[model samples]
Target: MMAATKRIALGAVVTALIAGLAGCSGLGTGGAGSAPGAGKESAPGAEGNSPAAAPKGAVNLIGDGSTAFTGAQPELPRAKRLKPGQKPPQFVVFSWDGAGEDSQKLFSHFRAVAKKYDAKMTYFLSGVYLLPEEKKELYNPPQHAAGRSDIGFNDTEGIRQTLAELRAAWLDGNEIGTHFNGHFCGPDGGVGTWSVEEWKSEISQAKAFVKSWKTNTPALKGEGPLPFDYDKELIGARTPCLEGQKNMVAAARTMGFRYDSSGVGNQVWPTKKDGIWDLPLQLVPVPGRAFETLSMDYNFMFNQSGTTQGDPDKHEYWGNQMRDGLLQAFDRAYSGNRAPLIIGNHFESWNGGTYMRAIEETIKTVCTKRDVQCVSFRQLADWLDAQDPATLARLGTLKVGQKPKPGWTAFLAGTAPGKAAVGPVPARPADQPAGKGPDGSGD
Candidate 1:
């Protein structure tokens, strides 16, 4: 179905996002403990879709390159232009915040799960994870003491392990976006109060952590560098505490960021803000309540238990609460309007590991279902961009949980002139199409 060419202004489409309304950044509920929320927060950050550059049999390296311009990233299936008259696939994005393979080993565990389901995820890597703890002082965060990080830095072994996972994850076609350094939140130097310059400083430092990990960490002196170029690879992020997004978006747009997942939204089609995609965390139906909850585990905990450690007896119930709510949210989009579902998580075993179980089960339950594509934010943005403006404008017309009247085929039956618009695919550096089996059998 070729699409119409209508466009809608963002302010008219996303009423949930109040301009200049502040909310706290960072959820601070993963790993060990949950911190108090910041006093303020706000919604906040293009065409993300570019085809994999097919390389011609060799690798190219940039100057002082900690990573190489490797051939087309393997294991990714080619995303074709959706044919006209076809319904959009149900896109479910499972993203991790403060991504690290810590003592819990959740990162590695989830990697295996994503592989089992042929799913791709976004890992928002906190830069300090790559930076050795001993070198913390090197990070000069704006407005704070040098080397100070709300999220603890890593040791050499941890860094090495994280690097290995990140390398493997990228090679497996996952995205590595920044979670920035120093997971600071709240009014006392929380990211909510940072200026555009400070946010830029934070971003630069985040990149510095990943790009210069080896230069700073002596133990990694001889080990292999990260697999991909950090400079060109990073294009999106989620702000800490979800605060300072008002300024973060401004800073990110200038840095070529393609998307930002910092605010809360209803289950609706996304639109642009600050010249990039504003893919916010959404509010989903709470299973047993009339009200909805944020599509994140920490928020569930915050509401249910007031912190990461909730009541032991209700842990199972809490897990089920999240699982059922996410599935409920999925059904509303899957069966109703066909809007994309964005879920955020951490690697911690919060509330007795119930949330982990919920996420894992959700993955197994949904990814294999018909018309479902568990993709990355980058992929989602690209898909949205490739679409016709009129089609998107029509999609935006369907409010939260509202189905297209007279059915999808009839609603999308009309086509304007021209070929079906296609999303941009990154040109690969290799001859073989990505995700081709090593044996040359596409299987």
Candidate 2:
């Protein structure tokens, strides 16, 4: 069994190393930036229903030539308003935190999976991953010393690999969002204590790293720029360990952000938080266990193995438990309220890589189902924006696992009782904090 003391020490080291970084001027990427379909008109032949053909347009290089405008991204589904009485399509957002390509090759591997399964996902790239360790001093975190990152920095080859994956992922209709830089969590100058301004600084640095990778990793300066303008592509993010959301949201609202997934919430239709769509991680069953936990791999591992590495013999069982639990959650939403199932994951191979297996299985099982749209958070947000406000309000009334009692036609035909002239649904009260595990260590 993994020792608790060792876990604690590791957590401390990670937290201490991940102090926030400083921002720099120039064309920077946006934090969890908005994806396409946020009210932008689609180009001809870019129907938004299917992935477009190879980007057809002159590649207009942006600042530092690290990213470019290659035209509307391919493979984005068109956001259409629901027909009268139409049952809303079930949306499942499979998003990765701190997305990067490393020796594990999970990023590229999943890109293939998404293509095979006809799904698109969101990749929240950590800024420091692109900033080589040699140029680490370029990062000046909010409260921590310069040149320090909990997750450390990447090498030129690592940056090149990550950039390639990012380029391909975006071309495949995936979103390139920011997980920010340094990943500072907990108290004591962690992200939780950051002011709105501090959050802004961190966000700026996150974008700067992406926009300036060509300058930082000079060895790979010949790399083609990332296809989309990150400032326009990023419109959302989940905070580090889900901390400091209050200030982060306040800062994000003004920084072109459209949504945030940094909170713990129920498996219900999402509502706006301070004008930003609050797409949070949901609570899902724990299989045989009576209680539910956040729909994340780390939470399940925390509840089962209690560490990144657990009993080898039980790895298969643990994997199945997580798979079954996620499927249960999917079934609940699929057959009932049809709330968009928001699932989060990391690329780490913790617990013998069982969670990765479970996630892949879950994707294979769910993405191919009829009427199920496995999409990125940006796509979900776009679909949400295309709906009639009253219809969405009516849909929100159904509780978790509670289907429309009167059938879809009647339930959403008109406004429900007591909800006159459906406007933006007021933000629901916060649910259990989902970012941290039982012991407060989570991805």
Candidate 3:
């Protein structure tokens, strides 16, 4: 059981084994029932996930027609630099690992939730989710057998449903990122031990799975290809179990990846490491608990029941704890330093599906609030790129839960004493690395 596993310290928080246990694979039955506020029409004219609408321009198919070159993706928001002395918006990223549609239909369910709230998210797709079980040998995971995948491969039906969701998600302005393949963890032959070259191989294979799904799954060959060219669409990823980040970032930076969410950090502004944004999962309040945990369902579960299926009697309490913890994290960032809140989750029904309910409630509450921008990691990176380097450096100086003492107007205006006048870019925290928070187990 996960409860019996040894714990690892992540800054002030302690987390359990970094295994891919939370996103364990299985194609179960039944669709996800309507989430709270499901029937509400999408905000204004936001596009719902009705079906894959034809691209605005020509559809030039790529390899095996698994993906295509659809013209500029619809509804992608442009990133604008903040006006001088203007306070930043409260950015919240709701991301998923091993994203796919199985019996629970979570991929489609959350797509509706995002549209209803006029929000965009990052779906870290596990490549094996699109690779059929019979074709598992096509994957060549470093240090592991060719056909071996910790989370297992998918069936043709599963692949078809997942592909449909991916197509609609991209067209809806959501970002489709990779979660790599083979949820391998631990010290032996795990991602944490793989070399930089091996990590690159794993990444390429992950992209290949998405690029050639049609050829791998013959039954789905005639289906419409994924709307966007995956090579360009995929610019970020979260490693399984949040391990192997040091080498992963090195390899990803060379591959044109702009950011990575494979590490743990405090609830402060993000900084770049090795030329890539190190946007990590953060430590948030745990409600009544004395210590905080990573802002992820798996960590909450580990500390609460210490098992995926905990005592049914306390399910509601556990769910409330997670929801409140995340909201608490949001409030501080929203009201304090105004740093972006990066959150991670999985398509799971753990603990009687309580976590799912908590996440939906969190989304409904925060995404609709004033000055809050519930966006994907890709969008956050874009916004970050648009900011003046000096301004970003100033923002990083604000500690966790610490607001600007001089107020946003004077502080950001470069009028405060001892603050640089938004000219030269100073060294960012990413250059002098800090202690990373604990890695959450599973996806």
Q: Which residue pairs come into collision in candidate 3?
A: 10-438
Model 1: runs farther than 4 Å from truth? 1-57, 63-65, 415-443
Q: Rate the local accuracy (lDDT) of all candidates.
A: 0.71, 0.75, 0.78
What does candidate 3 score on TM? 0.86
Q: Which candidate leads in lDDT? A: 3
The regions of model 2 sitting more than 4 angstroms off are: 1-57, 415-443
lDDT of 1 by residue, 351-403 (tens): 79998999999999888888888888877776777777777766776766666
List the candidates' TM-scores in order: 0.82, 0.83, 0.86
lDDT of 1 at 424: 28
lDDT of 2 at 433: 28
User: How many backbone collisions does model 2 have?
Assistant: 22
lDDT (tens digit, per residue) of candidate 2 on 120-226: 89998899989988999999999999997767777776787788889999888888888898877666677889999999999999999999999988888888898
Give the lDDT ranking, best first. Answer: 3, 2, 1
The residue-by-residue lDDT of candidate 3 on 182-294, one tens digit each, is: 88877878788999999999999999999999899998888999988888888899987787899998999988799999887778899998899999988777765545667
